[model samples]
Target: MKSETVGSATLETWSVEEVEQAFAANEIVLIDVRTPQEYIFEHIEGALLMPMAFFKAEKLPGQTEKRIVLHCGSGIRSEKMARLAIDAGVTKIAHMDGGFGAWKTAKKPYIGTDMASGAPKRVG
Candidate 1:
């Protein structure tokens, strides 16, 4: 028998710690599925703003090389977005178990943005 270390890049699902590690390593893609307004309020840092409404319409950007973590205000929208991504031939897909809310409750780090009708302002 032989043993080998499983690479972090091979993971399909991610916990808060795992997500944080992935982001820190720049080895995962964070996709935000909430509306622009909601996303502007607060979101995982480095997450790409690809709302669920655009999931089916817009061509998914980025390479399929890394795991994709989808999140929304709640888990619902992100779950739906995950399904869509899977259907669209995205094999590396995951969603925050409780979405952005849980992330906040867990005291995980995230970035906040201005929700006003203008360019988003990044805050921690």
Candidate 2:
């Protein structure tokens, strides 16, 4: 994980492993900043949906309760949203470095769609 000062706020960039570990420990809030269509198809299990188009810092979970980690399809949008949150005066924010693509590349498990049956299933 790496963090930098952004005005009065801090922005953290963490690798997929860091996010996965913390999430498994229930120590951080994982937020998916992707479209509903993308999320409905597949997503990290337990991640909360807050599409980029509708993202708002105030709508984010309190940082005081659990550290929030944002993620998207390929790390682009999530990083944008994290900076936006910081600019909105969120004291601290973070985003997964490579997003869901990296998570899948790393062979991490996620909730993926079963196209044949139109059902959700665990994928690794």
Report residue 121 deviation for candidate 2 (angstroms).
0.7
lDDT of 2 by residue, 8-69 (tens): 88899999999999999998999999999999999999999999999988877786778999
Model 2 Cα displacement at 50 (Å)?
0.2
Q: Specify the highest-TM-score model's number.
A: 2
Clashes of 1: 0
Residue 36 CA displacement from its true place in model 2, Å: 0.3
Report every candidate's CA lDDT: 0.68, 0.94
Candidate 1's residue-wise lDDT over 20-118, tens digit each?
777789887788889987776777768999877667623665565776677787678877776666666654467776778877888887766545755
